[model samples]
Target: MSEHRILKLFFFACLGVFVLHFTMTLLHNTPEKYLTPRMESYSHLWCYPTFHQGWALFAPEPQSKHKRMEMRYYGPSGWSEWYRAEHICMDQHIRYRVTHYSKLCHVTQNTVYHLWMAVDHFDQQDRPAEQFYPQNMGYGIAMVLAENYAHHFLPEMEVHTLQIRLILEDPFELQDPEVIHFPTKTLMDGPE
Candidate 1:
């Protein structure tokens, strides 16, 4: 193959990767923050606690709300600006059954991590959608029961629970992690 052909092939490969990544992100029911009323004033901050103890396997259980959404981290000032109704959205499934609980993570200075708000809820067809409405879409909580990576799938010695904390500052972090979430306890019942 000619040098030009090789370069062309490499360009196409990169393009393909980008497209696939974008499509997957959209399918994951990404919150269109750019379209929100708070976009002009929104910010995010985050953190991840060391989980050498064990992982908290979260899932939407019976008699609970099976819902999750992105909770952008903002400093104390930004958090103060947030009103429960103005900032967060619901999965509707939990509208009548369970109350939702959410908390933001705090990381060490100069540190970064993915804030696992929740995974996108998949439909009967296994497609991502909150309902019939694309805007209502979001991910469910990922079940993390412990912290260990015995599987070769993870880099040896690097297989450990992520100490990621995501902060959604108005400026936003240039890079971030893609952590997932799963519902834990029902909020309606209150205190475990």
Candidate 2:
């Protein structure tokens, strides 16, 4: 075969591989445990770059309320007063620390939301939160928050125990806000 023909054949072969990889990725629904190591690696290499995983950025789920993080640290006597992990900026100056922490909370919240959706879809048919959500999800986010809390706020305070509360607020309602507390042991245990 001529050199030009050989090059054309090679190009077509590469194109074919790319198409196959992309198609498999787009349609991939198999759980990781079933995939061989090589197959898993191949999927990671090809699929991750091509796919942008997330819900619609412009249109999110309907939110009647907003949630914020509140934390209390271990103190000499007992737990310190609960304070907002997120900063409240009254000044005009941009608070980058606040912005960064807020973004972390946002990401963690979204991660938990996605995990909840998956659990809801699969296992919640018969039994709901009692069966699966707590055991399977939110540990990663909890660890991230705990470590960040220690590193950022209570480095000198020797924070042995941390309690984080998710405070949900409704703008329209005058009623008391809802507060959900994460387990202190889970926060201290670090990521699994």
- Which stretches of model 1 miss by more than 4 angstroms? 30-192
- What's the lDDT for all of these models? 0.28, 0.57
lDDT of 1 by residue, 41-116 (tens): 2211111111111123442332112112232222222221211211222222234334321211111111111112
lDDT of 2 by residue, 13-129 (tens): 999998987766854546877888787667665654445322334446545556666667674456768766444221211456545555655655664454334434644465444
Error of 2 at 35 (Å): 61
Residue 8 displacement in candidate 2 (angstroms): 71
Model 1 worst lDDT window (10 residues): 141-150
Worst 10 residues of 2 by lDDT: 85-94
Model 2 quality (TM-score):
0.45
Clash counts per candidate, in order, are: 28, 0
